[model samples]
Target: MPYFSRLQERPKIISKLYSNVITFLTYIVTPVLLFVILFAEEIVIVLFDTSYSNIAVLIQILSVLGLLKSFSNIGGNVLIALGKFKVGFYWNLIWSLVLTLTLLVSLQYNINLTEFTLVVFFANFASFFVWHGIILKYINIPYINLTLRFSLVFVLSFLFVYLLKSFIMFWPSQWPQSIMLGTYFSLLVLVTAYFTLLLLKNQKTIIFTLWK
Candidate 1:
């Protein structure tokens, strides 16, 4: 973003820019991840086989981690651009330690895939806030505002996905042959439409940001 070059001269504008970027990214990312979570079973079955369907729940858990990592990736770049390398380093260090220790403990207990992924998710989630705190010191990110935006996206996507899933459940099972396969494509199209509508609504801002 051009705003990256002007951070020192205009902190307030940069803060607003950060807010916009975060909001844009949240909208772009949350629905995709939620879709994966909701349709993981069908996704696994299609891509692999029914035997691999057992790992669908594990994929759902990891999708949450993927969301956190995406946010962290942006924050890391911002921190490096702002010359806060040490802060990023410590955040990563803590994250690594927690993840390693958890994995070690889980290994000893012979943890199942879902439980093991939950441990990994919690570790990453713990560090996610720490990274945000570091960014707040440098950029004044609107935490409350971002939280509300994220919650809205999550809730809306969940409702949208579930309602569609419920609707598809009533369809004749033999028509599609595999009910999950039908549900998968239906949800995929619905999510694509939802994302397209969001893009249209924000097209002006997106164009301005891109051209700037």
Candidate 2:
């Protein structure tokens, strides 16, 4: 049987599992491995030379690009699982073209690395709107409604993180790296706790565990 037919037959089971596994492996594992391989040398240099700014710049650039590519793949995979393969293919193609053009233009104009990074991030985020429309076409889902609910929780979490960071910044600078790392993790915990409480209060369907 063709792939689309299989999806149509058992969408809730097959599609969900396929989408979840592929998303985890592609968005998580592949990117980590790629970063390790691509920047091994730069990472070592940064460890030895703490003042190395290139590594930070490289990280900023890669982080945005990685997010863009990962989300593009995710949107495509979701469309495929919903048995809208053509929409998946076309949108992915369009996103790829947009990224390529943006990259070329950035290079041509000699744009500052920070500005280039921001441009790429915005471009990637812009595609999500289009992807949401495509997802709704077949699923009849209100992407905006879902996004708003999640965004509320996300904003609250970010606020917690910001507050924690601000508090830490006021601390004495003589703190050990171990102490700094602990502080960072503590902030993460606090933000996560805040978000968890908000989610429970809102009683939103927890799709993250299902996908995980």
Candidate 3:
């Protein structure tokens, strides 16, 4: 949070910070999100056994907020630095109220956890847009570019997952083995996204730069 204050004295740092933050969120955090989303069963079963199996769904639900939470957290720091603390407070309040009301209704109606999970997702999803708007307004980030970059990472993560699935087919079907293989593939996704972005954004080829 304090690092954001230094950004005022050096306005250009905003772009750098945005770039680094997004890259970390994309290539680093995103694969973990995708992995957890896709392999919640394996993860929970392997880590905690079938006794607590119900938690897998809840974990998946909460993990959906990974990206949104990342953006909101960073935005919170930025807001505080800019002394736009009230805006952050209000947005958070709104989301909290939404979740609280929805949760109360769910409890009253005996809603399933899946339904409750969707409610949680929606609250975070909606609050993200509000925080994102603040980012565009105060942080000077262009929404178009940011959206495109995030979308690019999103697309590539799915692609990598698909490819990794094919390779994982040859591996043993044991839960522990599957988890290990999935992690290796997850790391590959990060590497592939990193280099792919470099090529797209900088027009820099890896070893293939030779014949050009």
lDDT of each: 0.74, 0.54, 0.69
Could you say which candidate leads in TM-score? 1
Q: Whole-model lDDT for model 3 versus the true structure? A: 0.69
lDDT score for candidate 1 against the true structure: 0.74
Q: What digit string (tens of lDDT, one per residue) describes model 2 on residues 118-171?
A: 777788778766776676566544345444644554455445445544565677
Taking all chains together, each candidate's TM-score versus the true structure is: 0.81, 0.61, 0.76
TM-score result, candidate 3: 0.76
Q: Is candidate 1 or candidate 3 better by lDDT?
A: 1
Query: What does the lDDT read for residue 162 in candidate 3?
Result: 59
How do all the candidates rank in terms of lDDT, highest first? Answer: 1, 3, 2
Clashes of 3: 0
Better of 2 and 3 by TM-score: 3
Residue-level lDDT tens digits of model 3 in 23-105:
55665677667767766776777777888778888888888787678756777766676667898888778878887987787
Q: In candidate 1, residue 143 scores what lDDT? A: 86
